[model samples]
Target: NQPGEVFYTEYTYRPWIQIDLQQFIVVTHVIKRDIRTPKVPPQDLYGMYVSKRQWDFVNRGARACFFGLTENEYNCRRPITGQYVTLTLEYEQDSYLDALMDLKVFGLPTGCGRSLGMTTGDIKDYQIETSSNYKDIHQSRAMQGIEGWCSSATDMNRWLMVDFIVPTEVQGVILHGWYQMKRMFIYSFVVEFGLQEHTLRLYGEDGLDPKIFTIDSIQDVHILQKFMFLQNILTRYIKIRVIDPSNDIACFKAEFIGCQVYGNKL
Candidate 1:
């Protein structure tokens, strides 16, 4: 029996048993724990452990749609609750395609909690948008005597590590760059981030895409966004793309603050 399954006649109640739909939500925390701190346990002392990966996000209503349950489109509903959802999260790191990252179920935390997000569905085939497609802005909107200009460092001769500092709790990050160079030379963009428990990653094999670029490296390697890479990883540092070789210098001046860590025993 299913919801709106055309109740030929009548049963005890409407086949549609309205149960709360679990809205898969994720919370994150970032910690800087150094086990080497004198008396700080042994070499096996971690900050925290998020024993659970898949969580339950409850969606309530008698005849509303659900987060994970498809087919129950409008005018229909399903039954489910208190059920631990199994997840196969896929990070949508593709900057070219417009996609929603998928089910990053759980986190085995350590040190501190940074941030996370609550989402619905199996987003295995989705990606995130990185570059802004502002191609329709009226040229008249441009400032008088303004010229279309771009600032570049290292240019195509260097690899730039594009790092993203997402506010705590933010689960998605979209990276963007240009491969406008008219060459077939090989290039690589690496994306990696880890917080003891949670993780985020994105990468690409080559760079020749003149269009959108995406990376779903956090999860799967299939489905690319134009030149997009796909990655569905649960981490505070959700985005980071770089190709800076030791020989290269001078990257685009991106605004960011730096912090220092010290070993205090007092």
Candidate 2:
């Protein structure tokens, strides 16, 4: 090591999830140095990127989280080393519950955000040897059919799809859609995702067999201008289908703008 030289060190983390789909969040940063420095002014951290999050609404089966990252590239000019600091993540989207359900059948636990499910007592992640199942079709129209606009002046519709990667060892499959909303105030529809590349048996929420080919690829869902957000999931993917909802969803316009995965491995 030479004078005026600096380096970064990280403490490794081992993650485990019991649920079939896992979403966990971790906050990380550098520890203050053990040694002291001259009485120079505090230095600033540069060239680092972080995510800023402020949650407004929290509910069961779903939550309203706004994720934006704070990014910068520079050196810390401060003279202090042993002080507390905070950083952010890059998951900049309103992650949903359907995204969670998509992986419950055949996906394995992996990466960050894999442990953040609605329930805590559940396993950190789970691997399924069974085939993944889901049906998407005309019956797929949900939130759109829900009556009452949260508020006017705001119109929006969102479509989401999750990809689940099952082992090549698996065979055929069956998929289902089950929805429950404690209050219909802001909730618009029953989100659905179709399974592609894999065959499936369709079942309705009422527990009856619905003999019909749901939807083709995610594109077949037919919602408009469905902006796609980057995300990290094992081999599986989850998608949400939101209707043209009014504003006043949350105490605000309840926006489902975007989401980004950490770019971690599957």
Candidate 3:
């Protein structure tokens, strides 16, 4: 006996559920299960967002229907490529209604580690003056058994840049704001990715770096905020600039997740 789970959305347009495998995978298939004898059947479509040189969006929801008693399980055997997969629900009526009993994603491992930030090069401008090396965003541990990246209180122009030491294929990035400190939580920020060393220097100068991918309205405070790229990007630098710190100060722990696709660049 499985618990009946209903997935619904409010008055929203194109509401979706994006899942990050944290690394690239050869997706064999995706199985979406629905409950039987339920109030309403799960009527939603599926799609894949794969990355090559850029992001490619494709609709793979071949056939989606419901059968009584035993719910119909939708299976898409489209071998998609990418690190991040977004499962979108399409409805006939205006109201957004759907149900999900379970979801199973079958794929092969890409042989990538957990966090790439551990080996990243020097972190820049996190703190004007370092103390106890506490401002080190690359450190995994904090003082008193706490774990986080601390920023200066008055550093209005604050940013954290991650250097891969080489051009590497990046899957995604995760941000964990200081949960213990209420005022240090970040509400909004900006992300920039670059492939050249000169671009990295120009980006820090302000209004210079070309915006490869940027998201402005992030409201997740003091929690693990994640952004998965649809396609793998081979870049040497990644930066996160604080915009609306929400608390006049910004502090966080960051993780760069991906793998080295090729050997170190010369």
TM-score of each: 0.22, 0.20, 0.52
lDDT of 2: 0.24
Q: Tens-digit lDDT track for model 3 on 1-266?
A: 25665555564554455556755666665665654454355334433343321223334332222112222343334565555555554443454425655666677767552456442433333322222233554443212124456656666776666666668777666765544645444555566667864575322223554333333335544445556655556778777676763435556666676777676442
lDDT of 2 by residue, 1-266 (tens): 34554432232221111121112222233222212342234332212221211111111111212122212222233321111122222222322111011111111222333222212312112311111112212222222332222222242433333233331111112122222253222232333333342333232344554323232233312222121122211223233333324443311011122123344511
- Model 2 residue 246 distance off true place after TM-score fit, in angstroms: 8.2
| Number of clashes recorded per candidate | 48, 52, 1
Q: Ranking by TM-score, best first?
A: 3, 1, 2
Instruction: Give lDDT tens digits, candidate 1, residues 1-266.
Output: 33333222123221111111122222232122122233333222111112112222222211122222111111112322221332111122311111212223232223222112111111111222122212211111112112211213324433222222332322222222222332111223444444321444343334433222334434321111122123223333423343434333211111111111222411
- Model 1 poorest ten-residue lDDT run: 136-145
Which numbered prediction scores highest in TM-score against the true structure?
A: 3
In angstroms, what RMSD does candidate 1 have relative to the true structure? 20.1
lDDT of each: 0.24, 0.24, 0.51
Off by over 4 Å in 3: 1-20, 31-74, 82-104, 109-147, 187-209, 212-220, 228-232, 243-247, 264-266
